[model samples]
Target: MSFSRIAFTVTAFFLTTSALTHAEEGKFTASPGLQLYSLRSQFKLKGVSRTLDTVKSFGIQLVELAGTHEMPIPEFKKELESRGLKAVSAHYPYKRWQTEPDAVAQEAKELGLEYAGCAWADHKSPMDEAQAREIAATFNQAGAALAKVGIKFFYHLHGFEYQPWKKGETLADLIIQETNPEQVKFQMDTLWVVFPGQDPVKLLEKYPNRWDLMHLKDLKQGVATGSLSGQTDVNNDVTLGTGQMNWAAILATAQKVGVKYYFIEDESSSSESQIPKSVKFLQSIRW
Candidate 1:
């Protein structure tokens, strides 16, 4: 072949390869399942088997636990497997586990969870610098305890944590620094991060590999700050794509950080209707 022709062919191949690479990298899926808390009322009405079947019908293949709904471990496992779903993680009260880590670990094992997480704990309000350090130490201790049992732990950040404690450092940052990543990771809630006047993308970028799970929730226009203390009408929870969060950017960053689970936590009164819609929206998303 002529040298010029060969060069042109090589250029075309490179361009095509680059484009394919970009497409694959940008791809995303709404695979992270529901918190079940999103559909608590529906689950109660439909019963566990029926609820899981409904969830599967929405194309959800995974879920995070809210409580076990008082089901025995074996019964819960059967219900989950019956619908071809898996529990990627679970949320339990920290104080409960703090006293009974072993029992908690057993339950997590039965549920087949990779992450056992706690949401919202107090570390004293208007935390001073010293208090912030103490808070970090407390988290580290909790994380270590969970880790000892081969159960991974996560700290689900609520908006109250966005407060600044020292110069150029926030409480969230301190938690990330203090807790060993091997012991504890973060589950970043998009709505919580945004409402606190902090950017989720920046948070993802700031902590490499620190976030493993995410709650794909959105804030309404007049809702209170990101703190869990603020109450918003659960009826307002909307489909994933329709929310105020810039999901494309958020998911893209999440994709970059290798976040494994993305739960659609629609704490809305319209959960039954919204669940299917949210699932369809998630299924429609390419990445």
Candidate 2:
């Protein structure tokens, strides 16, 4: 067979799913949602129309948006609604959440977001006590201001913040204990928490009330940890049930904590193939 034919076959195998059954008809029983960032590449490869149409076809109803593919926010909002997908929440640039909080609230409102947030915080490597405290201050401010407008503000955990701070705790602990519960809620990205060698269930139990949302990501086994770099290869992401995560316990804790939303985030080149399986895996899990 020609090289082109081989490549075509490989691509087809990865993108193919169980046909119209991809919609699964309410299969995802536990907090069903998608993090639009999972399809970041797809949105870039295909325009918003094609990309979201694919998402709609997947039967995903709730989405946590990353960005709008440069379409004006209103247009993007309209497009999502027209396609039957709801933007329950969104992640904006860290600086935007810090500097233009009012604008964040406005955009969240325009998109009909029940929740809005920043996925990362810019800080020094190792995230010193002082820097962690400073970030907590900013989070409190952003959270207070956003909450005033009737939208909940949350900070998404990115592994690196796990650098140990106090004698027994880490910087993440400072953020949780320092930030006002009413003002700043949290969204635990399970893979991020795990990547840094921190236990998501432990953190959830440590500060249950602080977590209002969660990013359900699974990490590949044998990845080195304890580094505070805050970045990694996106391809390391794998299908939910196949990775090195204990989803049954994690989701059980999340449901117990009253988490309001859960989004599957796949930052991999093969997310197209993996996502349908991820959805199926979520449906297969139980207490």
Candidate 3:
């Protein structure tokens, strides 16, 4: 080959290799955020300012708020802004969404959140179809109210919603069917899904558009599944890749289903130590 041609070929090879490496380095494309509730104890022990500093240190610029750590809404928003952190989503109580959705919308607006949701639906053990329908009605109403204020309303699934409803359907399915797709959306908490003996990928595929957000949590190995209790030891929460979850498949499916936001939520007592490892795992994962 001519010398000029040889030089060009070598340059092209190196450039292609570099591009591939760069892509692999960031295989998880969801730009994972943090759920501030993962640091709840820290906020209590170290206070909000110091706890926020810890969040910043983890290289997370986006967060999902549980509350303002008792700070006034405006003041909390300012604190987040000053530290270069943004609250993209938050979780409010189910009763608040049912009784005062407008108030919830106002608080979400004040906090500058784009999405607001309830993490757990208040229901009797082994949730039934009637309760599911009621919850769906509440979600639809709250969602519409929030939408009027330009904020999306969502529900974060806990394991309990998986109670059997009919032939090959669960209460979760009933709730999804009953809720308004455009008004009410869902957040798939990975651990909760897995703990209930459900597959995240299947659920995501089944209701693609309804899931706009995700909680990237993992259950510890050997934790029995098929439970509808929605109650588990917080310590069962584990770092992303170190747990029983098939992250490659779960995340790949989540991406395919158009989940817009992902948050790492470690409820274990060791969250401060586990979170960085989870972040690294997500960065390094390749599907």
Q: Assess every candidate by TM-score.
A: 0.85, 0.87, 0.92
Question: How do the candidates rank by lDDT, highest first?
Answer: 3, 2, 1
lDDT values for all models: 0.77, 0.85, 0.92
In the range 1-287, model 3's lDDT, one tens digit per residue, is 99999999999999999999977653578778999999999999999999999999899999999989889988888888889999999999999998999999998988888999999999988677789999999999999999999999999999899988899989999999998898889999999999989999999999999999999999998999988899899999999988889998888888888899999999999999999999999888986
lDDT by residue (tens digit), candidate 2, 57-125: 777889999988999988998899898889998888888877888988888888888888889899867
Off by over 4 Å in 3: 1-26
lDDT of 3: 0.92
Q: What does the lDDT come to for candidate 1?
A: 0.77
Return the candidate ranking by TM-score, descending.
Answer: 3, 2, 1
Candidate no. 2 TM-score: 0.87
Per-residue lDDT of candidate 1, residues 52-147 (tens digit): 887888778889988877788888988898888889888878665556666777778778788888876655665555665665665566667667
